[model samples]
Target: MTTNLLTRTHPRDDAAPVPPVRPHRRRRSLGSRIEPYLMISPTVLLILGLMVVPIVIVIGYSLMDNTITNPTPKFVGIANYLTVLGSPAFWGAAANTLLFTVVSVVAHMVIGVLFALMLNSKTMAKVPRAIFRAIYILPWIFTASVVAVLWRLLLDPSGVINYLLESLGLIHEAVPWLGLPQTALIAVTVINIWSGYPFFMISLLAGLQGIPSDLYEAARVDGAGPIRQFVSVTLPGLKPILYSMALLDLLWTTQQFTLIWATTGGGPLGSTEMLSTYTYKLAFNSYQFSLASTSAVLVLAASLVVAVFYVRRQRKEERR
Candidate 1:
């Protein structure tokens, strides 16, 4: 009986086990939840104010014939959109943009992959690899405006490139790269490729690095040649990254303005006039704000479509 009494706990053991103060705990939990929202609110507001609000204003303006000179804005209700769609100049600009974007992206992918493979090679010494990698990305470090201006100088009749070509006996006459309509598009494309490939190189190299060596080893063990192995193993592994880079590069190339502007200003008979250039000309040069707004909306829509495709592709890749 004494042992049982010693072992038995009192009716209230060690004072009542404290129930957490419900109100104070609830308040603390609420505060924790609210803190995250508070931290993000500023960024949310900035995006809404800067990006979303501007886009909304552009859309609204697309429906109105608004001008800086005019005090009143007349509602046109899709007239501006139709005008952009029907105009031959707009069509020409669209074609130019399409060609520029497609060719530039293709070149970027090919060159980016080649550079990535070279840099990622096990045979490459670290110092040389690092130096070459830095060189590849050097052009991208410069602003587009600076690059455009520099290239404009280099492509002039007596400029470095033409001089080099002449010195090499490749051409008898100094070819004006940005002056001829035929060469103007090609020159700008080359410039875009040079400036843009670095982005692809960085992304593709990172993707290549993420791939497992075991896969390559297995391919080799199966008697696969380098080309076959690359086609079979490397390409498949890098597919998702390639897709993502392709979409982003396409969009970026579509929006290219500075280089074309600073170099040729979409000139040589409007042969290099991209949609971005066209929009700029309409808004500022032609003082056609409504038309520019319509063009801007078209660009936005195109971007949105590409983004949707990218999202769907990502989902598919994730499943795979």
Candidate 2:
């Protein structure tokens, strides 16, 4: 038996060990490669749907004779664009929108910076600081619709504004704030400033907080007063934040809708008409979707111009 076992071929001893196949190895490599894309897919799809899709639709509509009355959209090329550009109403709205954006941005910058400075002051107690912060940001908490409605009630002829004015002998009679064409645009612009200033204020406050306290001390040591210190240290430090905030705020103010709509509906003979409100009027009220789309395209183009200018400015600043 021993001789037979020795002569028999020992397969196990002579053969090499085989490695088992690992199916999951390839799967793991693939998962690692695709994981980042999978994570960002939702955001990409959302942006495509929300921003790109609407822009494409607007462009398409601007080129077509599209309206509610006309179920079938016929391609009209640049006719709609030409018509919109030639329309007096369109030009008027554009002018108003431009003026409103400029005025509102300026007001926001001034008021916001002041508020931010006051908030950053060292004299305020902790409780008062907290309270002031809450109060200052309160406007931002309210929706544009709510703000518009509230302000409308206040500005009504028989409302608290006129009542107080009469009581103080400021005006012998109730003033027609919204009814007068002269005051309508200004009124809406003021409301826009009031509601929107908080955004700038918050941004400026953040910028202020990030500034090193030592810079102020150094400025003071160099015989700088409050104005000089602000001009040199504060403004320089806030430059980037200010630029970003102002550009974005300009875009938002120009596109503002709900507040102006709820207050005046571009009323008093379209005195308060803006690009945003005018677009709304053209679309739903007038059922001129093609012209509305044209307006939208123009506004988008203008906004792009602003964005390009901002990009250029930022590049120059960076180079400096």
Candidate 3:
């Protein structure tokens, strides 16, 4: 009985005792944890000083009647906005801007995806692929002014393209590509597509290369053809990249002005007029700074709408 009681009462004396764990270091307060912000203080200050302050001033000016010739500014409430909304020119510009954005973005995505797929092929050597990639990006690296001038030359009646086409009996006469409204729009859209697709191609190629080869192999093993494999595997994998690139392209193409201004100057009876170019003409040529500001605000609103829709769609996709 004594042995039994001793064994039960004093069991496992050689076993180690559990040590108490020290509590994790407490997180610093919001202000105390702001060292990163301090490190980037110069950039933050520069943005606020340059960008944010000017935007705020523009917002104020947009709310008032302040023209280029007017020395005195007056707060006219939403009158500027009303004027912009009532103007047929504003609607025309907005329509052109939207049309350009849609067409260019669609073309960019289609062409970019195709080019990326080609580059991603295993049959291409690394050297040739690199050379092709560099060549594709060369157009994007050119200054906008240079591209505009180059296209202007190309679109001229007796330019190399027209000469070649006429010599080949492809046309009866040299077409004034930028002089006519229809051709002008087409020329600008094509130039934008050519200049913009490289960025999308590079981004999409990276995304495609990240996708595991096993997915494609598995699809093939399951008796999937090329089209079927692309539909089932590639499309779903590239969803995020597509969404991001489309939104970026939409925003950029809608605001394009340099190429338009340098090429058409919103000419051919205002057919090529976009919001950005329209705003510039109003502020500078017509000396209507207030109206220009209002136009700019409208552009900002449209961009915000596009962005909001994209974000909502992305969230819906995520939920699904």
Candidate 4:
């Protein structure tokens, strides 16, 4: 038996059959590598077509004179930019934009944070909280055009607001809130504040909820009063959200056009004229398309600056 086993070849000792190589391995790998890009290609193309192309064309037009209106536009180099920069109207519009943006953003933050705090309070019942939230958020639900029209009616000389003020003896006569240069900017800023605060409130409320309960407990155990706890714990937890929201608000407020356009029409001697209104007047009213394009580019540059800060902040938060 031993002699027979030694003579027989074991299956393990036999030469194994070689499997055939997969011809499609390289193709499969290549497809795998390209799949993500193919999936994103539509979005990329859409952005390029819609955003990138328009921006490039605007930039190009900014460098030329009498663009769009003239068949053969002359290349004016930096002359258009220089002209826009040198204009007092542009400077005035810029100053108004700055005031509008700064005031709106600050008010939005204060009101939003305060409302968020009220909604997030533990003593508040859910039903009342919900009711107040709905009321507070109503402004944000209205479209810009709707908001503009609504405010215009309310601020009219014979409207409800003036009637109330007159009845309260705050003013002897009805005031045209949107008509006079003195109060036009203030009225629009207030309107913008009302429309914008709800977004901040919603965002900050979400941020408040994300704060760890343990942190609050620790603060309480340390004998921190409500004010102290808020100062140390609540504010710290909300800092990141506040920073991001503020930057985003800056960008949006800077580019605000629709509300300003519909409300005051940058009127009453250009009291409420913004960069947007200024650009619109340049292009359509003055027929200075090239100059308007330059202004548009300048606005884009400012927006980009804010966007860069926001992106960097997001990256820092992600890393942390």
Candidate 5:
């Protein structure tokens, strides 16, 4: 009986299979999880070394009286800022900067919107529209120096523009386009508008294209006229893009230097001298680095104010 029981128990145990062992799970440390940031360490270092360092230096220098000829910089607290604030030249430059930014941004938006609308029209030929867009963008692609030189040539008394005008009996004498103060300011403003409008046009055109054609079709079916559709649908759709472009244009125009420098050199009794040009002249030409820095700080403050206002307006509109 005992032998039989042992044999039965051994058979039952043999029929049962062994369970497979579970593999061990490896735990990742915090450093391993953040390895991606480690991979981009070089780029972060480069930005800090190149961009951040220079900006810090500029900020430091801005707080001190560092003349062009001086080897050492002396901290003068806020005295330099007070001097710049009190200067009539600074006020004039500030006014001119504001006028330039406002006029250029307004003109850019109006003209750009018109062009984008025309280009977005179904009746326009694709090839011709593309050519027109390319031509308009050419001015923006050209170097600032080249554009300045071209404008200088065109605006000169003996240039083709004046000669053609005189030949057509449009004028008895060649106008000194850049010689007079008012004319010089107008000329600079026109150049700025021309150079800047194409960028805004392209931006608005992209925004226009992003809008669904179905919306327009629906509007049409609902008895919405073109004017009504544009006002109610298109304008609202383009509001964000328009606001962004306007702010960008304002900032760019306010800080414009190369074109103005190459074209007018802030001449004709500083009539065309915006804040940027004024700051440059103060720093390099007049050897007043601290004062220049003060002006630059003011320019930065103005830019911040404009940007903040636009952002707030955008947020309010979005909430509604």
Candidate 6:
């Protein structure tokens, strides 16, 4: 009887009235929900004002004629795009940009991977590895303008490069590297490769470190040589990082302006002209803002495509 009375007391609460939530508790819950949004509002506003608004304005300008300079700009409905698309100079710039971007990306990958492998070598002493890493990363530490100026001096007709070549009998006379159409693009590309590879090297080095040592042990157990193990394990492990970095490098290299502008100014008969240079010339040099906007929009579209791939890759990695 005593046990039955003790267990039965709580069952009567189902028939009793329920307690209501307090107003203070409700207000606290609402405040908690709103706190995160309030904290991020400033950043959200900044992005809208800076990036999103400017991109929207540029897209709007691309669809109009005589933007900014004229008070009454007329809607041209893609006429600027047509003009830009039909121009041979635009095509030439696009071609130059393509070649420069592809070559730089490929060279960066090769040099970065090689350096990463060298640094990752178990045979390398710590002191030598640290020294080599610092030296290799030195180019990346310099600003684009500095890199351009340094390379310009190095590639000048009377520069140390020419002096060395002459002393070594590699060439009979001084070569104006940036002044010649045949060598301008190649020179800038080499310069870019030198400046850009450190990023890849750093990224790939981290990726290589994350790879399981057990994988290498397993590969050796199967009678795999160094080359075979690298091919089977290292490459596969680094593939995601490689793809993501390549896409980012492609986007960045395509939009490269300061280095090219400071070095060659897209000169030597337009041999090194890129889309960015073409857009800049149209807007500032020729005072053709509408056409420049169109070109800018086109470049944005290409960048967006690469960005989408990068984002998708990131999402896939997160899922794994």
Ten residues in sequence with the least summed lDDT for candidate 6 = 9-18
After superposition, candidate 1 runs with Cα above 4 Å error: 1-21, 315-320
Stretches of candidate 4 above 4 Å error? 1-19
Candidate 6 local lDDT, 74-127, one digit each (tens): 999989999999999999999999999999999999999999999999899999
Query: Candidate 6 overall Cα lDDT vs. reference?
Result: 0.96
Better of 1 and 2 by lDDT: 1
* Per-residue alpha-carbon lDDT of candidate 4 for residues 1-320, written as tens digits (9 for 90 to 100): 98678767454556688899986998899999999999999999999999999999999999999888999999989999999999999999999999999999999999998999999998999999999999999999999999999999999999999999999999999999999999999999999999999999999999999999999999999999989998999999999999999999999999899999999999889999999999999999999899999999999998999999999999999999
Local distance difference test values of all predictions, in order: 0.92, 0.91, 0.88, 0.95, 0.86, 0.96
After TM-score superposition, the amount by which residue 10's alpha carbon in candidate 6 deviates from its true location, in angstroms, is: 19
* CA lDDT, candidate 3, residue 179: 95
lDDT of 3 by residue, 208-276 (tens): 988989999999999999899889999889988899779878888888999999989998899899999
Which model, 3 or 5, shows the larger lDDT?
A: 3
- Give the distance in Å from residue 311's predicted Cα in candidate 6 to where it truly belongs: 0.6
Task: Flag clash pairs in model 5.
Answer: none
Model 4 clashing residue pairs (backbone): none
Candidate 2 C-alpha lDDT tens digits along 1-320: 88678767454576778989988999999999999999999999999999999899889989999755688878899999999999999999989998999999999999999999998898998899989999999989999999998999999998999999999999999888988999999999998899988898889999999999999999999999999999999999999888878888888888899988899998899899999999998999888888999999999999998888788878988898
- Give stretches of model 5 more than 4 Å off: 1-28, 71-73, 308-320
Clashes of each: 0, 0, 0, 0, 0, 0
Listed per candidate, the RMSD to the true structure in angstroms reads: 4.2, 3.4, 7.8, 3.0, 4.8, 4.5
Which segments of model 2 are wrong by more than 4 Å?
A: 1-23, 309-320
Encode model 5's per-residue lDDT on 1-320: one tens digit a residue: 99999987777654778897544322355657688998999999999999778666666667788744578777888888888999999999889888888899999999999988988887989899988888878877988898899989999999988999999999999998887896999998898888878888889999999998899999999999989999988998998899877877787888999999998898889999889999999888988877877787778878889899788977987898
Scored by lDDT, the top model is 6
Worst 10 residues of 1 by lDDT: 7-16
